[model samples]
Target: MSDAPAPTAETGTVAPPPRPHAVVAVLAFSGVVVSLMQTLVIPIVPELPRLLDAPASDAAWAVTATLLAAAVATPVMGRLGDMYGKRRMLLVSVVLLVAGSVTAALSDTLGPMLVGRVLQGLASGVIPLGISIMRDELPAERLGSATALMGASLGVGGALGLPAAALIADHLDWHALFWISAALGVVAGALVVALVPESRVRTGGRFDLVGGAGMTVGLVCLLLGISKGADWGWSSGTTLGLFAVAAAVLLVWGQWELRIPEPLVDLRSTARRQVLVTNLASIAVGFAMFAMSLVLPQMLQMPAGTGYGLGQSMLTAGLVMAPSGLVMMAVAPLSATVSRTKGPRTTLMIGALIVAAGYGLNIALMSEVWHFVLVSCVIGAGIGFTYGSMPALIMGAVPPSETAAANSFNTLMRSIGTSTASAVAGVVLAQMTTPFGSVVLPSENGFRTVLVLGAGAALLAFAVAAFIPRQRDAGSDRDPEGTVRAASGEGVAEPAAPVTRQG
Candidate 1:
């Protein structure tokens, strides 16, 4: 076809079209940078009290604040992206990230650091936004792999971040970490402005401030209760009370959404078999994925005196696991191929099985450093396959207009799964420890249990994916080429005129 931008069916306006490869590269780069926030401070997590000059418990908020902020921001940004513009919100998220990085770089206290971290967390929506942009712009044939690679960036950034952060922490001032983050965010933002174009799809409506408030309150309460339950005591009144409040708020919010003319999350769309099941599978996959993270690092770094421990340094541990990230990147194209041929549902089920098998292998081969590398790479491949298929399944089910919101909600499910995994694994390890002189160490059996649980979670994902109806059963009007015939020209109305071309 032509190199020039063509008039979109939704909005008959001609704008400059970015080259497809340039668009994918810029968006994927932006996604990796944004996901890097998840692990940006891992090297300093244990030393937060010393670096921030605060009480140990208080300094923990630096991490918790980011978690809480991201949980609230993901869906909100997705909805806003659908309403205003994905590119607009993407720019806003990047700006917040840069601002946050700068704030943390200059801070030497806990309060300021927590504020900075929260701002950084708010940028987590960029991945979902990137997926939405690709769907709107790319050809159907390229859509599967492009979005899969975008989705896999979450794991890729996280896996790569550990070694990078460890090396920087060892060689440079801690402040340099945030400075690097700031610089990276600036570069990603600049690239996006240069190459990404604003998609013409959008819905016009008042921002659902009430629904937004409700979701924020509900998610914060629910996630806080889950993440901090081990710390605060699972049965503590505080935990129970937060769960109670979350239940009440979410129920009210759901009812309100159904009654409203325009909703924050289209409950109706989300309830579709494909979307709902894929989201559930995402949670299980997330839980399974996180167990490897929790177990591997500690197993690698534990004192050699412990017969089961490999006894490596933090940098060594990171380097060993780094291959997993590369493996994830490599699997992105494979994942797309599987989805294209066998369908995303089949791809998800197969991925979950592979993850389960990887965990099983991990249990059998825990003594050697190479074993760790091998197991991580295997599980990483499984995770890549599953992650790659998720956006395809989601996009196939929901309208193009709600693409960002649906993907954001799916991402949120994964976050919840990881948080739950952290809490559950923490409790297991704490209760089942070996006494090594004055210090207590996590028992070898305890690690085994975590791995087994990871396998179980993966199996659960397989079961969930099995429930996702095939596209024909789903009864959506889609072509064999994977274009949604039902969705064409059935999205949000376009704005009267271009406000500004920058987005």
Candidate 2:
């Protein structure tokens, strides 16, 4: 019950006790578990209408609901983490996942299923929260690779879970998928409770209820329109109205954030050159990454008679994509080393170039399964590098107090990019289709065009990364709390002012 010892001027910040590895492992596991939810229902999406006795369009909400909920919850949860506690909020997120999984498992209708998916989506903050926790608790030496692996978990779980989910959906009752997720969520939550310690870095303040509400409304409107715009008809009044509302709400929200004493997101900090450029680059990288996901699967499964198609089954396609996840895991340490030596900016540029190369390669080699594997692995490795460096860049630029919120904002940028990619790819494929008997399918040229666009996005990210200002050694320029230290003529270090907190 007694308070722990505080750091002294001589000892500096005391490192946490010797369980860093365990902490990293548990956190990375939690990230993977959370990401698994993204693809858990993909195997069953096509059958949802029949199974739930709903229209296909209505059944599609099962996916759209999760996307909208995650977009709204990620930054909100992150801000809450900064105010209250990251670990506490993380546990709450996992609990939502568990509850959602159980609900979905028990449901026989679309209503309950949609509810459960939304709850699961609320858990998407786990990755950014985990990254923020690493920034606070891990040794400076251990932080880079730990965060890289944590970021890579997003791709790792999605790629790996597809095959697993397909296997489950094919062999067992579809309900078993949610049941498995529930078990995994329970394990992840318990591990976090036992292994992760709450940090001393709380940004104590009254919750910004107004800012939070504005952000939620704006993001919900914006993302809802983006995710469903194709279905609603891009030029339809419903879609256009939502877009206009989002723009107005976000403009007001931005003005409000700038004026507020305690805002949900610290706009001035985010406006810093380093943070701004990195976030911009993240969006492009995210767009590039998702385009591959959109194109490769279709190319792999289109009947072999299509000339370019590999004619693989859903399960086979998932298996082929699985190696990319493994490759990403393998690259994390190497990515960390590159960031350590050459700086994260260089690492990011290298990653962007690699991704562009991957897409370029895919354009030339779409005829064989091995070619898809090669391209995916290349892109995954690049993603591993880019994802790894993003947290380092964001953390280096922001105060420790705002770590979770800033990181969550970066994650949101990536999601926005992916959502945009989905929309763009959907439109391209829908517009350019080949007729086969009574049905139509996306043409090979349409898939090629998507891959070409993916390459262009990666190049764009590389161009943006080139503008980020260079920095000193990764951890040397910033203090334990991420406040940049200034050098004085007398050789004493001066700390940047702490971020303001209002009750």
Candidate 3:
């Protein structure tokens, strides 16, 4: 085995070196908490209708609000981090996570809860920022495995958070969920402060306020239109207006990005085949992953009177999902092995295909509770591989100095996928409902429809994955932000590879 590589400081900085192994582990663990905070509220969804005196449709906003906020914030934060530093951005995000969780825990109404969720969503930016930091700070030898593990955490924490949320909500109160998340955030913040070194890589550019506002407004309107169209009626003025605003703002933003010398988003480079293809696949993977989150909980928690429901309580339902996360944990190393052998492109394609296969089977096999668990296991496995492959693809496509920005852009794409999935699934559930006196309940058909959509998303992801270039080991590629020395003790040389992908 190759000995661990050293972390070289970026030019003009003289920070002390961190213990690479310890820093990597701490940062990776922090990721698990960040991931958990994203979905820890799902198990408590059932209680929201009663506690907030709201309908299920209204209660769903708890999830949708966070998704919207995170989707808007991620890319902007990432780009800003590139202009500033990844470590600095991460610390800011953690503070937001902690504050958001605490606010959510203290909330007494649905409105306040939504406010808290939006705050929590800010931390979602940390995921990509952390991945980018690995390129800047971690040893080259550990980069592959470290990044793969962080990717796995995205699924792992979500999977595990289900059970934790259920247990806390059942035994205590929903407030406890936020409290735990807050604690996790604080711990992550502290660890990051101690273990992670600040980025010496600096791009002296001003923040693009106009570009950020445009992207934010566009994403919010677009996601809101999708998520609420079912409830608001697709033809209603509200829905149509939101959609129009989303399209117009996004189009204008694209044009503005081209004109701006220092854009909030670097559209030119992002539109390159390698980056573009990877981001498209990332969106599909996000869609498929969110489908599981949306459909499974309903299947688990619906009343036993419903023929499709397993009739499990929130706690039990969460427990079932919890075990699935372990499957994803097992998948990371396996994906690493596949990535090394066939390359990241093949590994990602295979992962997406597996997800499609699992969703297709879910359509046929979802009659029983155990079937849900089995299907979740397959989905978890698929997500593990797909998530593991994405960062590697992004890292390979961009210069080391731009790692945080590039990864953040990819993360933004995934968030867009999740937001779209949630919106579409909400629409399906709303339309396919069983009338029960004054109340309407979602029927089995709704979930099945969502699963079919998920299968299509997986297929699309597979197609995108096909376009990513296979990794070559012909020459050593060093971080553009750091100095490089030849193995033979020769003077520092030119970087062996260009950051942009070759057609």
Candidate 4:
């Protein structure tokens, strides 16, 4: 086969085909659905204890189950998309979303609901595919803008889904929330079929069944251990065994991958200082984001008798989070401009700093509903900027053929971060609840502790982003074979030098 065409940036020497705005919209909408699935159930999580006859602690697993599945599936799907056509895999993911939602809507038992969440998690690959699609379909002039919108879709879908979920769950039954998601999934599926074009760049390789299965088992064990630990007892044999199994499986899998051709994940490139550091930062942001999502709703929905709560209904709490989505949407184009003006590294730094500031503000000003809303905008801006720069960094660091897989790996890191955060946050809340309490809810002290943890995570993310070495957009530094060279003090690869001689 002839060489695959290079992605046409406005400044790229070669230009790819021009994609219509409708196609871009379709790609972005798919991303929106993936993001919506991540947070749409938050309004109902606190109420799950009452609605499903489960403990509040047990109900939290519903969210973590979804996170685990998504984290494991994302990189696999990206690798599959790289081998097969992205359009084919993306369509399959949408089908999973529809089926998952319908199943969840019809189920009365938590068992089937957990099953549905795992299936829905399959859709997490859509965002990475959308980013990959931009490189294939959009001209150079549009790629940056299109990628920026795809990044923002994450925060936008999350922000918008809350109010809609709140409205439906409040007026109708909680099952209605899943039913609505099912309907939206059907619509999104149809739109994808109608508007999205098939990818021209497809690689030939067998699916790495062994690698995929190993990673899946390891991920499931790790996530299950973390998600259920508080309920299962941290020191219990079951949890301890799961942790040991996960560690062993993942370690063996990593070694296996290094020896295999067409590995499920290109761990060598992914482990590069640049890619590894960026992924670490992505995880921290994901952790902080989920921490905020969990804390805010509980605070907003608790009865007015609680000195720390505003006593708002679920619908009101959802509404408070809704504006953050709109603000995130508004910030995307701005992020694009920032990337062009100051480069992705600088843009990411600004975003990380904004997140730290937002968390700091939350520490000082979370008493009133409006205060929470105001702080959310700041957080949304941070998300928009940070999300946009991740792809730009990944795209510029790896070869063109590795784009989707690299992006998906980044997404997977974020999911892992979120899962870890959910687990840790649960532990913090579980430990910090006041003994003198009545029904015994997480007191103001629990929330303060969570916020402090979130702020510290954001600061760690900032440190990671701060240290990522600056590189140009051409990506020539990494070369087609994925080599790195050390320079004077910084680990700068010599872009202009011959690839063979540099390393």
Each model's Cα RMSD: 4.3, 4.0, 4.1, 5.7
* Candidate 4 off by > 4 Å: 1-19, 46-61, 435-437, 473-503
Candidates 2 and 4: which is better by TM-score? 2
Worst 10 residues of 1 by lDDT: 494-503
Off by over 4 Å in 3: 4-18, 49-60, 434-440, 473-503
- Candidate 1 has a TM-score of 0.93
Report the number of clashing residue pairs per model.
0, 0, 0, 3
For model 2, where is the 10-residue window of minimal lDDT? Answer: 485-494
Residue-by-residue lDDT tens digits, candidate 3, 171-269: 897788899889888889998988888765555478889998999999899888877887788999999999999999999999999998788877876
Clash pairs (backbone) in predicted model 3 = none
TM per candidate comes to 0.93, 0.95, 0.89, 0.89
- Taking the tens digit of each residue's C-alpha lDDT, what string does model 1 give over 257-359? 8889788888877887888899999999999999999999999999888999988999999998888888888998888888887888888998899999999
Cα lDDT tens digits, model 4, 1-503, are 12233423232343333335888888888888878987778778878777767777767667877888787878988888877777888888888888889888887777788888888988889999888767556544456667878988988898888888878777898888888888888888898788777665555577889999999999899888977887799999999999999999999999988888778888887887778899999999888777777788778887777778889987788888888788877887788777766777777888888877887898899789999898888888888888888887787666545667889999888877877887898898888875434477787888888888888888888888887877654222232234331111112243443311010
Better of 1 and 2 by TM-score: 2
TM-score of 4: 0.89
Residue 233, model 1: Cα distance from true site in angstroms: 0.6
Over 263-339, each residue of candidate 2 has an lDDT whose tens digit, in order, gives 99888888989999999999899899999888988888898877878889889888988998988888999988898
The superposed Cα distance between candidate 4 and the true structure at residue 314, in angstroms, equals 1.0
